[model samples]
Target: MASSKPKPDPLSIQRGDYARTLAGPLLLGLGRMVSIPLQHWLLTAHPLSHFGIPRPPSDGVLELPLVGAQPQLSTIFLGMTATLILKQNAWIWGYCAERITVPFAFFGVVVPAMYECLSALVFSYASSNPLWRKEFLYVGAAVHFFAAAVELGSELARARFKGRIENRGRLYKGGAWGLVRHPNYAANVVYGAAYGFAAGGPVYALFTGAFYWSNLTGNATPAKENYLAERYPEEWEQYKKDVPWKMFLGIF
Candidate 1:
């Protein structure tokens, strides 16, 4: 018999996802203690969440996949279909940006939005504790859904006026842009943290917050800055003064 190729070391296999490797099991064991109490404390602080706690999101937004679809879909069946299609459309267009929208509209506007949506799902599902139906599964789903909605909404806001305006590809300063420099990105961080909550360990949230935020901000911000300078130089410079939140870290 031919000799079998050597198996990859488990450690090496997981090196890229260090949080899942070194810290996942530990978080799994501690997810309940960390997620439940913190959730209670945080949600109870909000009148709406506290009131809704007993009823269990009658909208069943958690079960829904679009995660970001407007609750306005009205009918139950149509709503679900719309959400899935919308999300899938975003995934397809964003993924295929390389082929469409020249000079800038495609990649910068789409890729970051799509990556975060995927991350939301990953974070939500990965952190979820199958045993805790509501806490991990349902809750995790809700968090990611909200996360996707926020980013998509931001992207939509950014792209909406683009086609109508003379300079469709120009950097903007309105809607979410009105809220902060990167309100969408800031929301991504929040959703990512929520994914960690579902994952069960506060540690997961910390690692994601610290590492991913830093890297994405560094990469995207510079590119965006460059794009703004190249496309809307003066307006882009002023856009900074009006909205200075970096990852909504402080300026949300």
Candidate 2:
């Protein structure tokens, strides 16, 4: 019988290869920049109005004064952009993984770009509705900002813990980790839904929330748990007992 290869220790994975770290964020930023102009055109110019695209109300809440060539920004737009900027910086600086794989990076870029573009489209489509409230936009923006802060803070806490020499090979169980096994994942869902809500409304918010919840729970969270189990067999089991929740407390 042939000998099986030994599984590499998870702790051996290095952090932050410049090329891999930078590539994902740069690509994401490019995609976002492109989406901005597209969003502006969709909202203002209504270039696709002939193709069943309903024109936004000339005096709609979405219609703000233009600043030079660009449409005047809204709270929703600012929240979305700020979230992306925060995430990009986190990936470049705070993420502990050394090499972000090409497929994952591409997935990250494509998913967010699609979400942003589609959300804008949906929002524009719904703008003519008399029931659509501007307060939803402002409230969603606040939630988005709060979610971003939580995500960043939790990730930074973990990163700082991992950076300590004495903490090498040890599991992080403090800060937000004490609250849930995956606070960052929880925050991801919040911000994603918040962005959707701010961009469109309840329908978009539910869509985004469901998408993120499913993705994280079905894929990302399980994969991470398995990795942690392998890396810290005894500690992983204990941590699960201690935390009791995977991502959201009293929910998952």
Candidate 3:
């Protein structure tokens, strides 16, 4: 008889896991360093004006005067970078599995760096032009911050629950998980939408939100559920009964 292949260990450190962890902070940090100056230039210098990019008249719907907007934008970027770094560290140390491949690590680094660059560009343009009311910016920023908190908190809560000796091989259905099966994924969608809204307006927010929602629901969430079902068949079924919602509470 042929020997059975070894089962994968979630706790086992994989070849690229450490590199992925390191790359996340490095790329995000670099992006933050670049974004601040880039945004400042876009907001103050109007460097692209010669290219015929016209600025729209400010209608004062949460219109942040240019002077105030620069400082606020800087603060937003700073907060976002800090939050991302913290979240990255939390996932690596607390929740990440051996499934983090080198390609995935590379993807993670490139995407976040690109997002930071794009955000700096778009937000600067929107701030100058005053698209879709200014109040939405404040609202979006607030929602983004809130979603970040929830994401980080939920991840930490689950990590802590998993760390207990008695809880080995058990499922965590407490904290934010009690509210939704995948609170981190839910928060991810919210934050993406909120960030897009803060950057460009409602249309951008809708696009970004839909993107995250589809990616999570169609891919990440289902894969995770499948893994959990295989690993903890009894617990997962009961947990599903207890918490019917996957991401959102009332919808989905």
Q: What is the C-alpha RMSD of each candidate to the true structure, in Å?
A: 15.8, 4.5, 5.4
Clashing pairs in 3: 61-134
lDDT of each model, Cα atoms only?
0.46, 0.70, 0.68
What TM-score does each of the candidates earn? 0.49, 0.80, 0.75
> Which TM-score value belongs to model 3?
0.75
Off by over 4 Å in 2: 1-33, 51-75
Model 3 scores a C-alpha lDDT of: 0.68
Highest-lDDT candidate? 2
The Cα error of candidate 2 at residue 27, in Å, is 3.7
lDDT of 3 by residue, 146-166 (tens): 998899888878878877999
Is candidate 1 or 3 superior in TM-score? Answer: 3
Per-residue lDDT tens digits for candidate 2, residues 83-139, read 665576565555645655445556666666677767777667655645455677767
Q: Return the candidate ranking by TM-score, descending.
A: 2, 3, 1
* Ranking of all predicted structures according to lDDT, beginning with the best and ending with the worst: 2, 3, 1
